[model samples]
Target: MSEALLEGGTRCLRNVLGRFATGVVAVAAADPADGTRAGLVANSFCSVSLEPALVSFCVAHTSGSWPLMRGAGLLAISILGAQQRAAADRLAASGTDKFHGLPWISSPGGAPVLEGSLAWLECTVEAEHPAGDHTIVVARVRALDAIADGEPLLFYRGTFGGFSR
Candidate 1:
Protein backbone atom coordinates (compact mmCIF):
# COMPACT_ATOMS: atom_id res chain seq x y z
CA MET A 1 0.00 0.00 0.00
CA SER A 2 1.13 3.52 -0.68
CA GLU A 3 -0.04 7.09 -0.27
CA ALA A 4 -2.84 8.18 -2.61
CA LEU A 5 -1.57 9.63 -5.85
CA LEU A 6 -2.82 13.18 -6.47
CA GLU A 7 -1.36 13.89 -9.87
CA GLY A 8 -4.50 15.68 -11.04
CA GLY A 9 -4.57 18.42 -8.37
CA THR A 10 -7.05 19.08 -5.48
CA ARG A 11 -10.12 19.05 -7.67
CA CYS A 12 -9.19 15.69 -9.10
CA LEU A 13 -8.20 14.47 -5.65
CA ARG A 14 -11.57 15.49 -4.21
CA ASN A 15 -13.39 13.81 -7.07
CA VAL A 16 -11.38 10.68 -6.49
CA LEU A 17 -12.05 10.72 -2.77
CA GLY A 18 -15.73 11.37 -3.36
CA ARG A 19 -15.95 8.02 -5.04
CA PHE A 20 -15.38 6.45 -1.63
CA ALA A 21 -18.63 6.67 0.31
CA THR A 22 -18.78 7.43 4.02
CA GLY A 23 -21.31 7.66 6.81
CA VAL A 24 -22.03 11.03 8.30
CA VAL A 25 -22.10 11.93 11.99
CA ALA A 26 -22.59 14.99 14.08
CA VAL A 27 -19.98 15.76 16.72
CA ALA A 28 -21.30 18.06 19.40
CA ALA A 29 -21.04 19.39 22.92
CA ALA A 30 -22.75 21.98 25.09
CA ASP A 31 -21.58 24.43 27.74
CA PRO A 32 -24.30 23.74 30.29
CA ALA A 33 -23.62 26.93 32.21
CA ASP A 34 -24.42 29.31 29.37
CA GLY A 35 -26.27 26.90 27.10
CA THR A 36 -23.77 27.38 24.28
CA ARG A 37 -23.75 24.49 21.85
CA ALA A 38 -20.95 23.57 19.49
CA GLY A 39 -21.42 21.04 16.75
CA LEU A 40 -20.53 20.08 13.21
CA VAL A 41 -21.23 17.33 10.69
CA ALA A 42 -18.38 15.03 9.76
CA ASN A 43 -18.08 12.08 7.45
CA SER A 44 -14.65 11.16 8.75
CA PHE A 45 -15.74 9.35 11.90
CA CYS A 46 -14.28 5.93 12.69
CA SER A 47 -12.85 3.78 15.44
CA VAL A 48 -9.15 3.87 16.14
CA SER A 49 -7.61 1.86 19.01
CA LEU A 50 -9.69 -0.90 20.56
CA GLU A 51 -7.88 -1.54 23.86
CA PRO A 52 -8.47 2.03 25.00
CA ALA A 53 -11.79 2.23 23.11
CA LEU A 54 -10.64 5.14 21.01
CA VAL A 55 -12.72 6.77 18.26
CA SER A 56 -11.76 9.57 15.91
CA PHE A 57 -13.00 12.14 13.38
CA CYS A 58 -11.37 14.80 11.31
CA VAL A 59 -12.56 18.42 11.57
CA ALA A 60 -11.64 21.15 9.21
CA HIS A 61 -9.08 23.57 10.60
CA THR A 62 -11.46 26.47 9.95
CA SER A 63 -14.44 24.99 11.78
CA GLY A 64 -15.69 27.62 14.20
CA SER A 65 -17.72 25.22 16.30
CA TRP A 66 -14.86 22.78 16.88
CA PRO A 67 -12.93 25.36 18.90
CA LEU A 68 -15.79 25.53 21.36
CA MET A 69 -16.05 21.76 21.55
CA ARG A 70 -12.32 21.14 21.95
CA GLY A 71 -12.25 21.95 25.66
CA ALA A 72 -15.57 20.45 26.58
CA GLY A 73 -15.76 17.70 29.17
CA LEU A 74 -17.49 15.42 26.71
CA LEU A 75 -18.19 15.25 23.01
CA ALA A 76 -21.04 13.23 21.59
CA ILE A 77 -21.12 11.70 18.16
CA SER A 78 -24.52 11.08 16.58
CA ILE A 79 -24.33 8.77 13.61
CA LEU A 80 -26.97 10.23 11.32
CA GLY A 81 -29.61 8.05 9.74
CA ALA A 82 -31.31 8.36 6.36
CA GLN A 83 -33.81 10.84 7.76
CA GLN A 84 -31.28 13.22 9.24
CA ARG A 85 -29.62 14.47 6.10
CA ALA A 86 -31.06 17.93 6.71
CA ALA A 87 -29.37 18.09 10.08
CA ALA A 88 -26.10 17.12 8.47
CA ASP A 89 -26.45 19.79 5.82
CA ARG A 90 -27.30 22.46 8.35
CA LEU A 91 -24.49 21.54 10.69
CA ALA A 92 -22.02 21.40 7.83
CA ALA A 93 -22.74 24.99 6.90
CA SER A 94 -20.72 27.85 8.39
CA GLY A 95 -21.96 30.74 10.57
CA THR A 96 -25.50 29.56 10.94
CA ASP A 97 -27.86 28.28 13.63
CA LYS A 98 -27.48 24.54 13.23
CA PHE A 99 -29.89 23.48 15.93
CA HIS A 100 -32.71 25.83 15.15
CA GLY A 101 -35.26 23.13 14.37
CA LEU A 102 -33.44 19.95 15.26
CA PRO A 103 -34.39 17.93 18.33
CA TRP A 104 -31.71 16.49 20.58
CA ILE A 105 -30.91 15.35 24.10
CA SER A 106 -27.96 16.04 26.31
CA SER A 107 -25.76 13.34 27.71
CA PRO A 108 -25.03 13.18 31.44
CA GLY A 109 -21.67 14.63 30.47
CA GLY A 110 -23.32 17.57 28.66
CA ALA A 111 -22.87 16.60 25.03
CA PRO A 112 -25.85 16.88 22.70
CA VAL A 113 -26.95 13.65 21.12
CA LEU A 114 -29.20 14.35 18.19
CA GLU A 115 -32.58 12.70 18.17
CA GLY A 116 -33.15 9.90 15.62
CA SER A 117 -29.52 9.00 15.26
CA LEU A 118 -28.63 5.46 14.22
CA ALA A 119 -26.02 5.21 16.95
CA TRP A 120 -24.31 7.49 19.42
CA LEU A 121 -21.03 7.69 21.29
CA GLU A 122 -19.96 10.02 24.07
CA CYS A 123 -16.28 10.63 24.60
CA THR A 124 -13.56 12.81 26.04
CA VAL A 125 -10.95 14.42 23.83
CA GLU A 126 -7.78 12.36 23.89
CA ALA A 127 -5.53 14.00 21.33
CA GLU A 128 -5.45 16.36 18.36
CA HIS A 129 -3.07 16.75 15.46
CA PRO A 130 -2.71 19.13 12.55
CA ALA A 131 -3.26 17.23 9.33
CA GLY A 132 -3.29 19.23 6.13
CA ASP A 133 -6.39 21.49 6.24
CA HIS A 134 -8.05 19.42 8.95
CA THR A 135 -7.48 18.56 12.59
CA ILE A 136 -7.39 14.91 13.53
CA VAL A 137 -9.32 14.38 16.77
CA VAL A 138 -8.82 11.22 18.74
CA ALA A 139 -11.14 10.58 21.67
CA ARG A 140 -11.60 7.86 24.24
CA VAL A 141 -15.14 6.50 24.29
CA ARG A 142 -16.79 6.67 27.68
CA ALA A 143 -20.31 5.71 26.68
CA LEU A 144 -21.94 4.36 23.53
CA ASP A 145 -25.24 2.97 22.33
CA ALA A 146 -27.07 1.65 19.31
CA ILE A 147 -29.93 4.05 19.01
CA ALA A 148 -32.61 3.69 16.30
CA ASP A 149 -32.07 0.76 13.99
CA GLY A 150 -31.96 2.10 10.44
CA GLU A 151 -29.85 2.64 7.39
CA PRO A 152 -27.17 5.33 7.67
CA LEU A 153 -26.90 8.56 5.71
CA LEU A 154 -24.07 8.37 3.25
CA PHE A 155 -21.95 10.93 1.47
CA TYR A 156 -20.66 10.04 -1.97
CA ARG A 157 -19.88 11.79 -5.21
CA GLY A 158 -20.33 15.12 -3.36
CA THR A 159 -23.94 14.39 -2.49
CA PHE A 160 -26.05 12.72 0.15
CA GLY A 161 -27.53 9.31 -0.51
CA GLY A 162 -28.93 6.36 1.34
CA PHE A 163 -27.52 2.87 1.58
CA SER A 164 -28.90 0.20 -0.73
CA ARG A 165 -28.56 -3.60 -0.97
Candidate 2:
Protein backbone atom coordinates (compact mmCIF):
# COMPACT_ATOMS: atom_id res chain seq x y z
CA MET A 1 0.00 0.00 0.00
CA SER A 2 1.03 3.57 -0.55
CA GLU A 3 2.24 5.78 2.35
CA ALA A 4 -0.85 7.97 2.06
CA LEU A 5 -3.11 4.95 2.36
CA LEU A 6 -1.28 3.74 5.49
CA GLU A 7 -1.53 7.16 7.10
CA GLY A 8 -5.20 7.42 6.28
CA GLY A 9 -5.81 3.95 7.64
CA THR A 10 -4.16 4.83 10.95
CA ARG A 11 -6.28 7.96 11.35
CA CYS A 12 -9.41 6.01 10.44
CA LEU A 13 -8.66 3.53 13.21
CA ARG A 14 -8.30 6.33 15.76
CA ASN A 15 -11.50 8.02 14.60
CA VAL A 16 -13.43 4.82 15.00
CA LEU A 17 -12.01 4.18 18.45
CA GLY A 18 -12.89 7.72 19.55
CA ARG A 19 -16.55 6.73 19.48
CA PHE A 20 -15.97 4.75 22.67
CA ALA A 21 -16.40 6.74 25.89
CA THR A 22 -13.64 6.71 28.49
CA GLY A 23 -13.01 8.13 31.95
CA VAL A 24 -10.08 10.50 32.40
CA VAL A 25 -7.40 10.02 35.05
CA ALA A 26 -4.19 11.66 36.12
CA VAL A 27 -1.19 9.34 36.56
CA ALA A 28 1.66 10.67 38.63
CA ALA A 29 4.85 9.87 40.51
CA ALA A 30 7.19 11.76 42.80
CA ASP A 31 10.87 12.01 42.02
CA PRO A 32 12.94 10.34 44.70
CA ALA A 33 15.83 12.75 44.31
CA ASP A 34 14.01 16.10 44.09
CA GLY A 35 10.64 15.07 45.58
CA THR A 36 8.92 16.67 42.57
CA ARG A 37 5.73 15.12 41.34
CA ALA A 38 5.18 14.70 37.60
CA GLY A 39 1.84 13.77 36.14
CA LEU A 40 -0.43 13.79 33.09
CA VAL A 41 -4.13 13.43 32.42
CA ALA A 42 -5.09 10.48 30.24
CA ASN A 43 -8.26 8.76 29.15
CA SER A 44 -6.41 5.59 28.33
CA PHE A 45 -6.64 4.09 31.81
CA CYS A 46 -8.16 0.59 32.04
CA SER A 47 -8.18 -2.48 34.22
CA VAL A 48 -6.13 -5.33 32.85
CA SER A 49 -6.68 -8.05 35.43
CA LEU A 50 -8.35 -8.96 38.70
CA GLU A 51 -6.44 -11.83 40.26
CA PRO A 52 -3.26 -9.87 40.60
CA ALA A 53 -4.88 -6.47 40.40
CA LEU A 54 -3.29 -5.23 37.25
CA VAL A 55 -4.09 -1.98 35.43
CA SER A 56 -2.81 -0.29 32.35
CA PHE A 57 -2.64 3.12 30.69
CA CYS A 58 -1.13 4.62 27.60
CA VAL A 59 1.26 7.53 27.28
CA ALA A 60 2.51 9.21 24.17
CA HIS A 61 6.13 8.57 23.27
CA THR A 62 6.86 12.26 23.46
CA SER A 63 5.38 12.69 26.92
CA GLY A 64 8.04 14.05 29.25
CA SER A 65 6.15 13.27 32.43
CA TRP A 66 5.81 9.58 31.68
CA PRO A 67 9.55 9.12 31.65
CA LEU A 68 9.95 10.63 35.08
CA MET A 69 7.10 8.56 36.43
CA ARG A 70 8.57 5.41 34.88
CA GLY A 71 11.77 5.91 36.79
CA ALA A 72 9.91 5.94 40.10
CA GLY A 73 9.09 2.64 41.78
CA LEU A 74 5.43 3.52 42.27
CA LEU A 75 2.77 5.72 40.72
CA ALA A 76 -0.65 7.06 41.59
CA ILE A 77 -3.45 6.74 39.09
CA SER A 78 -6.14 9.24 40.12
CA ILE A 79 -9.44 8.78 38.39
CA LEU A 80 -10.56 12.36 37.93
CA GLY A 81 -13.97 13.51 39.04
CA ALA A 82 -16.10 16.04 37.20
CA GLN A 83 -15.06 18.89 39.49
CA GLN A 84 -11.34 18.37 38.98
CA ARG A 85 -11.02 19.97 35.58
CA ALA A 86 -8.35 22.31 36.88
CA ALA A 87 -6.37 19.40 38.22
CA ALA A 88 -6.55 17.70 34.87
CA ASP A 89 -5.36 20.80 33.06
CA ARG A 90 -2.64 21.43 35.60
CA LEU A 91 -1.24 17.95 35.23
CA ALA A 92 -1.45 18.12 31.46
CA ALA A 93 0.38 21.44 31.20
CA SER A 94 4.11 21.93 30.68
CA GLY A 95 6.71 23.26 33.15
CA THR A 96 6.74 22.93 36.94
CA ASP A 97 4.20 23.16 39.76
CA LYS A 98 1.80 20.57 38.44
CA PHE A 99 0.53 19.93 41.94
CA HIS A 100 0.38 23.62 42.87
CA GLY A 101 -3.03 23.93 44.50
CA LEU A 102 -4.17 20.32 44.33
CA PRO A 103 -4.76 18.54 47.62
CA TRP A 104 -2.93 15.25 47.91
CA ILE A 105 -1.14 13.00 50.36
CA SER A 106 1.70 10.55 50.15
CA SER A 107 0.95 7.01 49.19
CA PRO A 108 2.65 3.96 50.72
CA GLY A 109 5.38 4.15 48.08
CA GLY A 110 5.77 7.90 48.49
CA ALA A 111 3.81 8.81 45.38
CA PRO A 112 1.43 11.75 45.43
CA VAL A 113 -2.04 10.60 46.36
CA LEU A 114 -4.53 13.08 44.99
CA GLU A 115 -7.74 13.74 46.89
CA GLY A 116 -11.27 14.21 45.46
CA SER A 117 -10.74 11.66 42.74
CA LEU A 118 -13.25 8.91 42.14
CA ALA A 119 -10.54 6.37 42.91
CA TRP A 120 -6.80 5.91 43.11
CA LEU A 121 -4.55 2.97 42.34
CA GLU A 122 -1.02 2.90 43.65
CA CYS A 123 0.96 0.66 41.32
CA THR A 124 4.35 -0.41 40.15
CA VAL A 125 4.97 -0.60 36.43
CA GLU A 126 5.38 -4.24 35.47
CA ALA A 127 5.71 -4.10 31.72
CA GLU A 128 5.80 -1.72 28.77
CA HIS A 129 5.19 -2.14 25.09
CA PRO A 130 5.31 0.16 22.11
CA ALA A 131 1.93 0.47 20.48
CA GLY A 132 1.65 2.72 17.45
CA ASP A 133 1.96 6.33 18.66
CA HIS A 134 1.90 5.50 22.37
CA THR A 135 3.50 3.21 24.91
CA ILE A 136 1.25 0.86 26.83
CA VAL A 137 2.23 0.70 30.49
CA VAL A 138 1.00 -2.25 32.49
CA ALA A 139 1.23 -1.95 36.22
CA ARG A 140 0.49 -4.17 39.19
CA VAL A 141 -1.68 -2.46 41.78
CA ARG A 142 0.02 -2.60 45.14
CA ALA A 143 -2.72 -0.57 46.80
CA LEU A 144 -6.00 1.11 45.91
CA ASP A 145 -8.50 3.58 47.37
CA ALA A 146 -12.07 4.06 46.27
CA ILE A 147 -13.71 7.36 47.19
CA ALA A 148 -17.42 6.75 47.12
CA ASP A 149 -19.11 9.80 45.41
CA GLY A 150 -18.98 12.32 42.60
CA GLU A 151 -19.51 11.96 38.86
CA PRO A 152 -16.54 10.91 36.76
CA LEU A 153 -15.06 13.18 34.13
CA LEU A 154 -15.59 11.62 30.74
CA PHE A 155 -13.72 12.08 27.52
CA TYR A 156 -15.55 11.64 24.24
CA ARG A 157 -15.12 13.11 20.79
CA GLY A 158 -12.14 15.15 21.92
CA THR A 159 -14.06 16.96 24.68
CA PHE A 160 -14.49 16.61 28.45
CA GLY A 161 -17.94 15.98 29.90
CA GLY A 162 -19.83 13.97 32.51
CA PHE A 163 -21.87 10.81 32.35
CA SER A 164 -25.49 10.21 33.22
CA ARG A 165 -27.27 7.23 34.73
Candidate 3:
Protein backbone atom coordinates (compact mmCIF):
# COMPACT_ATOMS: atom_id res chain seq x y z
CA MET A 1 0.00 0.00 0.00
CA SER A 2 1.29 3.44 -0.93
CA GLU A 3 0.01 6.80 0.35
CA ALA A 4 0.07 9.64 -2.10
CA LEU A 5 -0.96 13.16 -1.16
CA LEU A 6 -3.32 14.68 -3.68
CA GLU A 7 -4.94 18.06 -3.80
CA GLY A 8 -8.71 17.79 -4.12
CA GLY A 9 -9.42 21.45 -3.32
CA THR A 10 -12.57 22.77 -1.69
CA ARG A 11 -14.97 20.71 -3.75
CA CYS A 12 -13.15 17.54 -2.82
CA LEU A 13 -13.16 18.43 0.86
CA ARG A 14 -16.90 19.17 0.72
CA ASN A 15 -17.64 15.99 -1.20
CA VAL A 16 -15.59 13.92 1.21
CA LEU A 17 -17.30 15.43 4.21
CA GLY A 18 -20.70 14.89 2.61
CA ARG A 19 -20.10 11.18 2.80
CA PHE A 20 -21.21 11.35 6.42
CA ALA A 21 -24.98 11.78 6.55
CA THR A 22 -26.43 14.23 9.03
CA GLY A 23 -29.84 15.23 10.23
CA VAL A 24 -31.36 18.48 9.03
CA VAL A 25 -32.51 21.14 11.46
CA ALA A 26 -33.63 24.72 11.26
CA VAL A 27 -31.91 27.18 13.53
CA ALA A 28 -34.13 30.21 13.97
CA ALA A 29 -34.19 33.25 16.12
CA ALA A 30 -36.18 36.44 16.53
CA ASP A 31 -34.92 39.93 17.23
CA PRO A 32 -36.03 40.67 20.74
CA ALA A 33 -35.98 44.38 20.02
CA ASP A 34 -38.12 44.42 16.86
CA GLY A 35 -39.77 41.00 16.69
CA THR A 36 -38.17 40.20 13.34
CA ARG A 37 -37.52 36.51 12.79
CA ALA A 38 -34.65 34.85 10.95
CA GLY A 39 -34.27 31.20 10.08
CA LEU A 40 -31.83 29.01 8.17
CA VAL A 41 -31.69 25.32 7.53
CA ALA A 42 -28.48 23.58 8.63
CA ASN A 43 -27.13 20.07 8.41
CA SER A 44 -24.20 20.76 10.72
CA PHE A 45 -26.27 20.91 13.88
CA CYS A 46 -25.02 18.45 16.47
CA SER A 47 -24.84 17.77 20.17
CA VAL A 48 -21.50 18.96 21.40
CA SER A 49 -21.57 18.32 25.13
CA LEU A 50 -23.98 16.62 27.48
CA GLU A 51 -22.73 18.00 30.78
CA PRO A 52 -23.85 21.52 30.03
CA ALA A 53 -26.46 20.41 27.51
CA LEU A 54 -24.76 22.20 24.69
CA VAL A 55 -25.14 22.04 20.94
CA SER A 56 -23.13 23.33 17.98
CA PHE A 57 -24.04 24.44 14.47
CA CYS A 58 -21.91 25.93 11.75
CA VAL A 59 -22.92 28.98 9.72
CA ALA A 60 -21.02 29.95 6.62
CA HIS A 61 -19.19 33.24 6.54
CA THR A 62 -21.35 34.25 3.60
CA SER A 63 -24.63 33.74 5.43
CA GLY A 64 -26.48 37.04 5.45
CA SER A 65 -28.99 35.91 8.04
CA TRP A 66 -26.43 34.61 10.53
CA PRO A 67 -25.72 38.12 11.70
CA LEU A 68 -29.36 38.71 12.58
CA MET A 69 -29.12 35.85 15.06
CA ARG A 70 -26.42 37.60 17.04
CA GLY A 71 -28.92 39.86 18.75
CA ALA A 72 -31.09 36.93 19.71
CA GLY A 73 -30.80 36.17 23.41
CA LEU A 74 -32.45 32.92 22.51
CA LEU A 75 -32.31 30.70 19.43
CA ALA A 76 -34.70 27.92 18.54
CA ILE A 77 -33.82 24.75 16.67
CA SER A 78 -36.41 22.63 14.90
CA ILE A 79 -35.54 19.08 13.90
CA LEU A 80 -37.37 18.62 10.64
CA GLY A 81 -39.49 15.56 9.97
CA ALA A 82 -39.16 13.34 6.94
CA GLN A 83 -42.14 14.95 5.22
CA GLN A 84 -41.03 18.56 5.68
CA ARG A 85 -38.78 19.02 2.64
CA ALA A 86 -40.66 22.15 1.61
CA ALA A 87 -40.09 23.73 5.00
CA ALA A 88 -36.41 22.80 4.84
CA ASP A 89 -36.05 24.23 1.35
CA ARG A 90 -37.84 27.41 2.29
CA LEU A 91 -35.54 27.98 5.20
CA ALA A 92 -32.47 27.14 3.14
CA ALA A 93 -33.22 29.70 0.43
CA SER A 94 -32.07 33.27 0.68
CA GLY A 95 -33.90 36.64 0.56
CA THR A 96 -37.40 35.20 0.66
CA ASP A 97 -40.26 34.99 3.12
CA LYS A 98 -39.00 31.91 4.91
CA PHE A 99 -41.85 31.92 7.35
CA HIS A 100 -44.58 32.56 4.86
CA GLY A 101 -47.31 29.90 4.97
CA LEU A 102 -45.41 27.98 7.61
CA PRO A 103 -47.07 27.11 10.89
CA TRP A 104 -45.03 28.21 13.86
CA ILE A 105 -45.18 29.81 17.23
CA SER A 106 -42.93 32.06 19.24
CA SER A 107 -41.24 30.57 22.24
CA PRO A 108 -41.52 32.36 25.54
CA GLY A 109 -37.89 33.27 25.11
CA GLY A 110 -38.73 34.96 21.79
CA ALA A 111 -37.39 32.35 19.37
CA PRO A 112 -39.66 31.30 16.52
CA VAL A 113 -40.55 27.64 17.02
CA LEU A 114 -41.81 25.90 13.95
CA GLU A 115 -44.74 23.52 14.15
CA GLY A 116 -44.56 19.82 13.16
CA SER A 117 -40.91 19.49 14.17
CA LEU A 118 -39.75 16.15 15.44
CA ALA A 119 -37.97 17.93 18.30
CA TRP A 120 -37.32 21.46 19.47
CA LEU A 121 -34.52 23.09 21.39
CA GLU A 122 -34.62 26.66 22.62
CA CYS A 123 -31.13 27.83 23.42
CA THR A 124 -28.94 30.81 24.09
CA VAL A 125 -25.56 31.54 22.62
CA GLU A 126 -22.88 30.29 24.93
CA ALA A 127 -19.76 30.88 22.90
CA GLU A 128 -18.59 31.41 19.33
CA HIS A 129 -15.39 30.60 17.53
CA PRO A 130 -14.12 31.48 14.10
CA ALA A 131 -13.52 28.39 12.08
CA GLY A 132 -11.83 28.53 8.66
CA ASP A 133 -14.57 29.80 6.36
CA HIS A 134 -17.43 29.20 8.79
CA THR A 135 -18.39 30.22 12.28
CA ILE A 136 -18.86 27.62 14.95
CA VAL A 137 -21.74 28.60 17.18
CA VAL A 138 -22.06 26.81 20.48
CA ALA A 139 -25.37 27.24 22.25
CA ARG A 140 -26.65 26.15 25.62
CA VAL A 141 -30.06 24.54 25.78
CA ARG A 142 -32.57 26.33 27.93
CA ALA A 143 -35.73 24.52 26.94
CA LEU A 144 -36.11 21.28 25.04
CA ASP A 145 -39.07 19.28 23.83
CA ALA A 146 -40.08 16.69 21.30
CA ILE A 147 -43.44 17.65 19.85
CA ALA A 148 -43.71 14.76 17.48
CA ASP A 149 -42.45 11.23 16.91
CA GLY A 150 -41.27 10.16 13.49
CA GLU A 151 -38.24 9.69 11.29
CA PRO A 152 -36.16 12.77 10.59
CA LEU A 153 -35.01 14.11 7.23
CA LEU A 154 -31.49 12.92 6.48
CA PHE A 155 -29.06 14.68 4.19
CA TYR A 156 -26.40 12.58 2.49
CA ARG A 157 -24.06 13.37 -0.37
CA GLY A 158 -25.77 16.76 -0.74
CA THR A 159 -29.22 15.24 -1.16
CA PHE A 160 -32.15 14.32 1.04
CA GLY A 161 -33.33 10.76 1.63
CA GLY A 162 -34.84 8.63 4.36
CA PHE A 163 -35.41 5.02 5.28
CA SER A 164 -38.71 4.73 3.46
CA ARG A 165 -37.63 6.80 0.51
Top lDDT model: 1
Ranking by TM-score: 1, 3, 2
Between 2 and 3, whose TM-score is larger? Answer: 3
How many pairs in model 2 have backbone atoms within 3 A of each other, for residues 3 or more apart or on separate chains, i.e. clashes?
A: 0
By lDDT: ranked, best first: 1, 3, 2
lDDT per residue as tens, model 3, 96-157: 97888888877767798888889899999999999999999999999998888898899999
lDDT winner between 1 and 3, please give it. Answer: 1
**For candidate 3, what is the TM-score?**
0.92
- Lowest lDDT sum, 10 consecutive residues, model 3, at 1-10
Which candidate's TM-score is highest? 1
lDDT of each: 0.89, 0.88, 0.88
lDDT of 1 by residue, 125-161 (tens): 9999889999899999999899788999999999999
Report how far residue 164 has shifted in candidate 3, in Å. 4.9
User: Model 3: which residue pairs collide?
Assistant: none
For model 2, residues 67-149, the per-residue Cα lDDT tens digits are 89999778999888999888887888877678888898788789987788888889999999999889999999999888858
TM-scores across all candidates?
0.93, 0.89, 0.92
lDDT of 2 at 112: 88
Q: What's model 2's overall lDDT?
A: 0.88
